[model samples]
Target: MRNWEDIGYLQIGTSRQRQAHAAFERLGILATLNAFGPVLAGTIPLNIDLPSSDLDLICEVPQLALADFQLLLRQHYGHLPRFSLQETMVRGCPSVVGGFEAEGFAWEVFGQPQPTRAQHAVRHLLVEYAVLEAGGEAWRQAVLTLKRQGLKTEPAFAQLLQLPGDPYAALLTLENLTSAELRQRLPPLRP
Candidate 1:
């Protein structure tokens, strides 16, 4: 696993980045994940994100203990506005999806079983790590810009960047492109 620096969390490109970092730090997301389980996935960890984008995260749990997980969320974030938690699944693994408002931003979390490739979270996490290692700031900038245009979801946003395939595949594809080329890359709107 890469250090926080290597993971690009220390980079502060925009106010949104600063807020996301501060919130994650104050909330002890990684610490919480460590206590309960592994972080199956996270979008903010990429270092470049839209101001309006909620932190997308997934954690592993003993099982899909939705009630217990909700208790934990309540313990840590009950005070947050618009807080809501429900039982769900991520790629067949029992899971919980929770949403809340904090620090003037929204946070969406999915807690699932021990991560596996079957989980979209796990696959996307791998791709995110790859992009961080190979794409650097250019990839981050390109992603952020694309996101600001209201193309917030993956694969679709990835497609617009013309990187290649879906989001995960596109990240893999984009990671290999030159930083200069990536910075200049323009996203297109389509199906």
Candidate 2:
């Protein structure tokens, strides 16, 4: 099995050329995930240009009460950053859990009210550690469905793979871009 550190480094190296403080974030996220169960572990729709300093996360704790989850946080990591619970208009009709900022990045949570038919199907695809950790057909189908819907899969995939967002976006964006073209457009990464 690949250690989180190795997977994390691979993600950083493949996504962006620059080395950033990723291991610290990785450890923090692992601690949170182990403590909180399966939840969103980082910022979504990451900035494609600049680096993000913190992990943004959320989860649907329908089976567990909000207070219970908060208790878990207090028991493990103490006070969390400021965030709110809200429901809002969203493309996927996402259920809002709350919004908060941690470290330097913002985190939001939404407990999806009731799963839509599409979501119902997507949610049961056997995600492990937030990734499609098995059942290749299910994973592929889910990815295609999300892609056709014009949803963001790359970020989710990165989280599952334990990679940072900026680098992930960088690699995805650069796949079709030539080296010269990329260098001409994006600033050089300082070592």
Candidate 3:
């Protein structure tokens, strides 16, 4: 599997993935947010995205830099279609979320006062990737099917695995398991 941190792999990925690469490159999304340590996190990166999935980019913005971060996003993306920026509390911490449309995709830039890799989105992405890797193509299809039924990614996985409680928190429990271990928890593979 390609390292999720490096988007270069997307160039040779599925059609949607390639389109995402083109969109990102044409818009200079990464470079524009370089100062904030951006990491693309979401179904798009994992190749489990539906037609409506937006380009989700997570960034590390210190609390003291929140204003500047919001200003920077506005300066660069405010003119795009449906541009909107807001500040809110996420998981008890301040967050800055900006959305716009560009290069044939909806883009969301999420900023939190913490490292990108340490964020819940990144961690959930890693675990989801691991589960897909362990379960193989069939499991991938299952996830897509569940998504098409209107269940969010984490909830779909939780339902499939019969997990209890909050799906997001439950999914994290499998994060440290190896492929073999994950396979044991997953349903038996179809022949």
Q: For this target, which candidate reaches the highest lDDT against the unseen true structure?
A: 3
Which lDDT tens digits does candidate 2 get at residues 1-191?
Answer: 32322224334442432222343363364465443333333312121223432333444443345456555445444455674554454446534455555545544433433432123212322122223333243544544454455545554344333445663443343334444553344332222
Tens-digit lDDT track of model 3 for 111-151: 99999988999989988888888888888898899999999
Report every candidate's CA lDDT: 0.61, 0.39, 0.91
Residue 121, candidate 2: C-alpha displacement in angstroms:
14
Candidate 1: RMSD over Cα atoms? 5.5
Candidate 2 TM-score to native: 0.34
How do all the candidates rank in terms of TM-score, highest first? Answer: 3, 1, 2
Native-vs-model 3 lDDT? 0.91
**Consecutive 10-residue window with the lowest summed lDDT within model 1:** 4-13
lDDT of 1: 0.61
Looking at model 1, the pairs that clash are 155-167
List CA RMSD, all candidates.
Answer: 5.5, 13.2, 1.5
The estimated TM-scores of all candidates read 0.66, 0.34, 0.96
Q: Alpha-carbon error at 96 in model 2, in Å?
A: 5.8
Q: What order do candidates take by lDDT, descending?
A: 3, 1, 2
Return the clash pairs for model 3, or none: none
Off by over 4 Å in 2: 1-29, 35-60, 70-81, 85-96, 111-191
